[model samples]
Target chain A: MTAALHALLWIAVTIGLYGAADWLYRKSGHRAFAHPVLLPVVVLIVIFEASNLDSAKYLASTQVFSTFLAAAVVGLAVPLYRSFDALKENRVAVMVAIMGGSVSGVISALIPAWLLHAPEGLIASLLTKSITTPIAVTVAQSVGGIPAVAAAVVIVTGLVAALIGPSVLRLVGVDDPVATGVALGTAGHAIGTAEAVRRSDVMGSVAAFAMIVNGLATAVLLPLIAAVVG
Target chain B: MIKTLAGIGFLVLLLYAVDGIKQALGLPVPSAIVAMLLLTFFFASQRRVPDFVDQGAKALMRVIPLLFIPPLVAILDVRAMVLSHPVVLFLAVTGSTLVGLVVTGLLYKALVRKRGRV
Candidate 1:
């Protein structure tokens, strides 16, 4: 394919795919589990891989989709900016929740591995499981873990949060938008935030900041695990 | 504009010593994840951190799906990628996720319930 044609084709597919995803999320009443970000990509990954399509071929055809991703994420700042007032007001509580959530999240993942007698490598990679993919992958690799396994775990972790989080929150009778967003964002990342936005702008906003906070906590905490596990 | 630059700058710094650090530490890490956590913490402590960097980070955060696609796609026959011990691995992953979700959920509530969010 000509470079122009390749770019055009990729852009068209990405936009088309994302459009379908956006519609799905909107259709889902903005639930975290209904996030368009990962689901469509998973489907696309399935198709591309099954068809034996090279990533370079897919990239040549799909680079345009990144524009969509950029727009979506940047657009998130709108809610993030708007909720600054709420975030500022509850900054202290959010901080504590983030730290607690981070430790709890890592422990949650690792404790299971220990119970299952999962290797030290699996446990170490998962210690950063709830964080974003890039971070998760790197953390997984750092502790003599597997990046691919970490990636899968990160996806599943986020997916589980997106799928069942709200219902759980409701079950607990917690309707506080701040808690909802922070919890989802801390545990789920972009997908959670999308769901958070659906729940409430404040939740989504808190979720965004929570993501940052959790990342910070993970960075500081994981190295310590290396010390303690020693 | 500024945010884009900040994000780009963030990426550069992230890519710089993280690989070396990971290698030097000879840790079992995937260098990128460690770098992300470090950046996140560093950004966390600064007074309100740079909104530019935040803006930049937010953009990167958005298309996170894309990052995931490449790898999952690379796996080709993922079912077969299970490396002959698929059940064990799947259990390890799924088990960890369930534990992570339920525990983290309860812990967050427990930690801050007494604080009474504002």
Candidate 2:
């Protein structure tokens, strides 16, 4: 097969796989484990290993999806714009909570990995674990980390947080919608925000606000911090 | 459909412009983020989301998760590194995420209560 045809074939397969995964996710009532991104990724990885196909070739073949990822990141502006009123109402509280969460999130991830002597690339990737995947990938690449590792770390973080974040918040006496939303979004990004949305509209909007702000702040800050630390 | 497509085209154009600016100015921030901020500002200044932008953004959001797959699949390349320290990595990710969640929530709740008293 010509290179272009090979790429097109893989792209079709990926899209088909994603469709199946989405169906599963819906069928499972949107369980976190059944997330659309997880199954297809696992299946693809298994296929590559079984066939001894180069992962890099698969990544290259799906380059168009990455471009769409960038466009989706831009699309975030729409929700952010819609959430401006919520943000405006409690600007100080929201900003402070998000900043605190973001700082502690970065530090908590880094200190453990550093003490454990994880690889430098892994350590750098951990820096953006709390942010959404696209911005995390961007920051990871900028800071000399592997984009793939960073994306994986992000998904893991989001899943962990979404599963337990609300309970943890309740244990700590954070029952308010705004606080719950802010906490979930700050820690888990999109996955946590989805959970927050399922709880309440107020929670959903606040979570979306916090998630976007946290991502934007990390995207701007992580690279600068990396440069200075180096 | 036409408006949504046009809005997407406009967004792509904006992304290209931001990329150029990022390169010229040597900005460390991602162009997608810069585009997001600029688009947010544009909507704010207009005081309403244009139909095209709203439709376009919704269309894009529908399939955004699909975009994440290719990159996540790239994890195959570093499976060894990840597997080697699975316990430590798991602890760090879960611990940090929990700490972040609790701290942000409690602090926000405390601040809001404090404001209510005042």
Candidate 3:
């Protein structure tokens, strides 16, 4: 096949696989482990390994999707704007909570990896684990980290938050819906917001609000911190 | 359809502008983020999201996860780096997430209690 045809073929395969994965994710009632992003990636990795296809070529073939990802990130302004009123009502409290969560999230990830002496690239990737995937990937690349690793770490962190974040919050006496939502959103990003939505409308809205704010804040903050510290 | 297209076109224009600004100012922030902030500011100033932008944003948001797949799939290449210190990786991700959740929750609660209905 010509290079163009080859790229087209892989792109089709990726979208088809993602379609199937998303169908399964919805059918499974949006379970954290059954996340739409997970299955297709696993399947693609397996296909790549089994066929001995170069992962770089696959990435290149699907570069259009990455562009869309950037567009989607920019599109996030709509939701952020919609959520502004909710955030405005508790401006100071919400801002402080998000800042605290974002800062601690970065510090906690960094200190552990730093103490373990992970490579600089790995440390940078870990820096954005708590943010949503799109922003995390961008921040990671800016800070000299691997975008793929940063995306993976963000997914894992979201999974962890979806699984036990609420329980942990409850154990610590965080029962209010707003607090629960803020905690989950701040720490979990989109995945945590999913779980929070299942709990209550207030939790859901607040979680969504927090998720966006946290992502925006971290995207701007982490890179600056990386520059300052370096 | 035209409205959606216009919205998307406008967003692309904003992205280009943000990129130019980033380059000129040597800002470390991502252009996409700057676009987001600019869009937010625009909507805030207008006190309403235009129909075209809202349509465009919703259309994009619906398939956002699909957009993430290609990059997420690239993880295969970095598996070795990720798995190198599995224990530390696990600790860093999970521990920080939990700590972040609790800290945000507690702080919000404390602040709300102090100020009343915040």
Candidate 4:
């Protein structure tokens, strides 16, 4: 079969699998383990292994999906726009929250890597853990880390943060909606912001702002930190 | 449907345009991030977001999780390195993420109190 044809089939399969996973997640009362993203990915891996399909070929065909990921990032602007009033009013607090979060995110990740004696490559990947995937993968690549590993680590970090972030926020006395949004977005990126928006429109917009600012901050801060550490 | 498609098309164009500019300028930020920033700036400048654009963006949001699968599945290739030191790696990533959340939340609480309602 032509490569294009091969890709078409896989794309259809992927979407079908994802739809099924989404249905299952909803049916199962939205269990974490049945995560639409995670569960579909797991199923894909098993199917590929069973069929002996070349993983690289599948990836090559599905490159279009990655492009959509970029658009999705741009789509985030809608929420920001929707929450413009709150964002404008709290610009200073937002700036402080993101800067504080971004800097601490880098430090918190790096210190543990150093203490654990992780290899340079692993440390490099860990550096981008708090940022969103596209930027995180790019940052990882620039710093000599494995991009795939970095992307995986980024997703896992977001997932874990999204799962536990709200409770942690409450425990720490972060009762304000803006604070909750900023905290989740800064630490969890889009995945965390997904949960934040569920809380309220105000929370969602602030969270989106936090996620975007944090990404930009990490793009600049991480490289500087890497150079300094070296 | 057409409005949604048009909105999506507009976003994709903006994303690629920003990416092109980043490549031309040799900027440090990734194109996706730059696109988001540029879009946000543009939207904010407009004062009122278009109905079609808002609807389109909302549609895209529903599919965001699907877009992530490709990268997550790419993990199969690097499973060896990740699994080699699972304990330490997991600790570093998850532990730092939690720390970031707590520290940021706490700092935000203090700053909000000090600034008096932000």
lDDT per residue, candidate 4, A1-230, as tens digits?
A: 99889999989988998999989989998777787887889888998778978989989999998888788778888777766677776677778878887777777777767877888888788878888888898888887888888888888888888777887778877878888888888989987877777668888888888898888777776778678867
- Using TM-score as the measure, what is the rank order of every candidate, best first? 4, 2, 3, 1
- C-alpha TM-score for every candidate: 0.67, 0.85, 0.81, 0.91
Tell me each candidate's i-RMS in Å. Answer: 5.8, 2.4, 2.8, 1.9
User: Compared with the true structure, what per-residue lDDT tens digits does model 2 show for residues A55-173?
Assistant: 89888999988777677667667767777776665779889999999999888888878888888988888888998876888889999988877888897788778767887788888
C-alpha RMSD by candidate, in order: 6.0, 3.1, 3.7, 2.3
Global lDDT for candidate 4?
Answer: 0.81
For residues B73-93, what per-residue lDDT tens digits would candidate 3 score against the true structure? 776777898779787689877
lDDT of 3 by residue, A80-170 (tens): 6766676666878988998899888878988878888988988888888988776787789998988878888987788688777887888
* Predicted complex 3: CAPRI docking category: medium
* Minimal lDDT window, size 10, model 3 chain A: A193-202
Candidate 1 residue-wise lDDT, A1-230, digit = tens: 78788768665665567668768878988665556655666677767657766666766465544343333443444455555666775566677766666666666555555766766766665676677665566556656776766676666667667677777766766556777777787777655666676556577778867765676567666767787876
C-alpha lDDT of residue B35 in model 2: 89
Alpha carbon deviation, residue A54, candidate 2 (Å): 2.5
Instruction: Supply candidate 3's per-residue lDDT for B85.
Output: 77
After superposing candidate 2, which stretches have Cα over 4 Å from the reference?
A133-148, A162-177, A190-205, A219-230, B24-26
Task: Calculate model 3's interface RMSD in Å.
Answer: 2.8
Q: Name the docking class for model 2.
A: medium
Q: Model 2 chain B — which ten-residue stretch has the worst lDDT?
A: B57-66
